[model samples]
Target: MAKLFYVLGASGAGKDSIMNMVREQLRDPLMVAHRYITRPVSSGNENHIELSEQEFDFRINRGLFAMHWQANGYRYGISNEVCDWLAQGLDVMVNGSRAYLPTAKARFGDQLQVVWIFVTPEILQQRLQCRGRESAQEIAQRLERAIAYDSVRPADAIVIDNSGSLQSSTEQFLTQMENTVQGQKIKVAMDSPC
Candidate 1:
């Protein structure tokens, strides 16, 4: 069966950069799911579909989203199209929310694989400062939150330390995916009847 690789991390953990690199280099059946968000496209580096608050409500009422959550004063959603992809036996990856992991895991069950991308606090602090998007106080708060989140990360999550070069992080992510695919193939082969 296909799996959903749920990628999540704190701000400045390089999730976007590493995922973008993986998207460019991956040659497998895994498809990355784009999120629909209430935030404007220009506000961040993520390539999400922007939706008005009213539009988001309409979709929610229509059951168009497979999963949805609110964070940082905005709503984010993953379309039901991801379900279609999984049904078609294509593995899917979604940039996910740390707070929404429980709901996602409940929905996807055994098919969900959590991938936590992280960096050392020192590196994360430097990255946040360099981004210049937050005030000093806000950055400090973020760093504290990141540390707290790291402490309670899911026990089964595949953790990637992304404090070094992007290339190294990308390679680690790719290796994880390759291993998962291979393991699935092995299980399928073993389950088939002679």
Candidate 2:
């Protein structure tokens, strides 16, 4: 069975860059799901499908999203096409919200694998400053929240410390995915009727 690798991280933890690198190098049966966001498309690094508020509502009404959540003053969703990929035995990765993780776990059950990207406080501060998307005050607030979330992150999550080189982080991310795929194979074999 394929798994849903739901990745969670703080804003400046470099999740997008790491995921992009993984996508380029990954040769496994895995697919990355682009999120549908109500925010307009910007020159930002996040690779997401932008939608108007009305369009977002229309999709919600039509049951087009497999999972949806509101955060940071915007609505984000994963399309139902993810279900199709999983049904076809493809591992799917989604850039996921920390708050919505419980719902995802409840929905995906044993098939959900949580990947938590971690970064040091100093590195996070520098990245946020360089991005110039948030004011210093806002960046401070985000750091506080990141620290609190780090304290309570799920015990079962696979942590990838991305404070160093992107290449190293990419290697770690790929290793975890490979481990998950191998473990899934073992589980399937053990569960098969003799």
Candidate 3:
């Protein structure tokens, strides 16, 4: 059995970067689920499969997505193929949406772990600004949304402050993730009939 880790964070919280770093460092078997996004990939970061809105909806209708959500005006989804990796006993990490935790929990039960990465408003603002993806007004709106998310955070989630260096944040995240998985049984429906 493999653990499922859902990484949630604001736009500039470096969620993707932290996951990438951990993936590279871990000697144990692990998999990071690449998201299906309705946006064109850029050199910026975050590995994802691109799709049009029509194509995205088509997949959703066909039950191809295990989980999906719309945020920041984009559609994001976790592909059903992730179950295969998990079935192989590979720990899975994904850039997950906080809004979709309920669905994830319902599907995977105790196998699901939430890792919330966060940054200070000042750092978040700076990082988002550097991405140049949105206007000043849009950035402010995202910052406000982050604050709102904090107030409703899940009681069992492991939170990490990403307001520092990439190395520091990545290390902190990995430590917390290991702690969460220690001695806990995480299954991926490996024994089920397809």
Candidate 4:
């Protein structure tokens, strides 16, 4: 049996950056599950299967997704096709939603390994602004949403702080993935002080 590594974070928490690095370093025997999103595919980011709202809902109604949720005015989904890969004993990772943890956990059980990537509010604001995808008010709203989602972070998650250098955070994320793939206890110093 393989683990389902669920990567969770705030809107600007750099989940994609870490994941992209992980992909470059770890090729075979690991998979990063791409999402089916209602958002138009952005340049130089995760390649998602983009669909219109109507098409997304049609697929959902057809039971094509293993898990799905709406956030920030977009619908995201992981296709049921991944279940076939899981059964092949391949470790799979997903850029996941915090709101959908309970549902994902129920599906994967002990195979679910939560990796929570976090950043300070100041860093998050700066990153969000740099992305040029949102206005000041929209950025504020995303930060507020982050505060609410933080409370839902799983107790046993391997936490990583992505507030500083991307290289450092990506290395930490790689170690986490390596351990998971080898069935070793994930070793990492907690990013949080509390």
User: What's the lDDT for residue 69 in model 2?
Assistant: 99
Report the lDDT tens digits of candidate 3 across residue range 24-109: 98777788889999989873587889999999999999999888999988999989877877777677898988778788878877
Tell me how far the alpha carbon of residue 76 in candidate 1 is from the true structure, in angstroms, after superposition: 0.7
As a TM-score, model 1 comes out at 0.93
Give per-model CA RMSD: 3.6, 3.2, 2.5, 6.1
Clashes of each: 0, 0, 0, 0
Error at 34, model 2, angstroms: 0.6
TM-score for each model: 0.93, 0.94, 0.91, 0.89
Tens digit per residue, CA lDDT, model 2, 44-122: 6898999999999999999999899997778999999888887777789999999898888888777788999989999
Please list the C-alpha lDDT of all candidates, in the order they appear: 0.87, 0.88, 0.83, 0.83
Candidate of highest lDDT: 2
Off by over 4 Å in 2: 189-194
Candidate 4 — what's its lDDT?
0.83
Please give the TM-score that candidate 3 achieves against the real structure. 0.91
Off by over 4 Å in 3: 185-194
Runs in model 1 lying further than 4 Å from the true structure: 188-194
Candidate 1 local lDDT, residue 156: 78
lDDT of 4 by residue, 152-194 (tens): 8888897889987888898888787676656543433222110
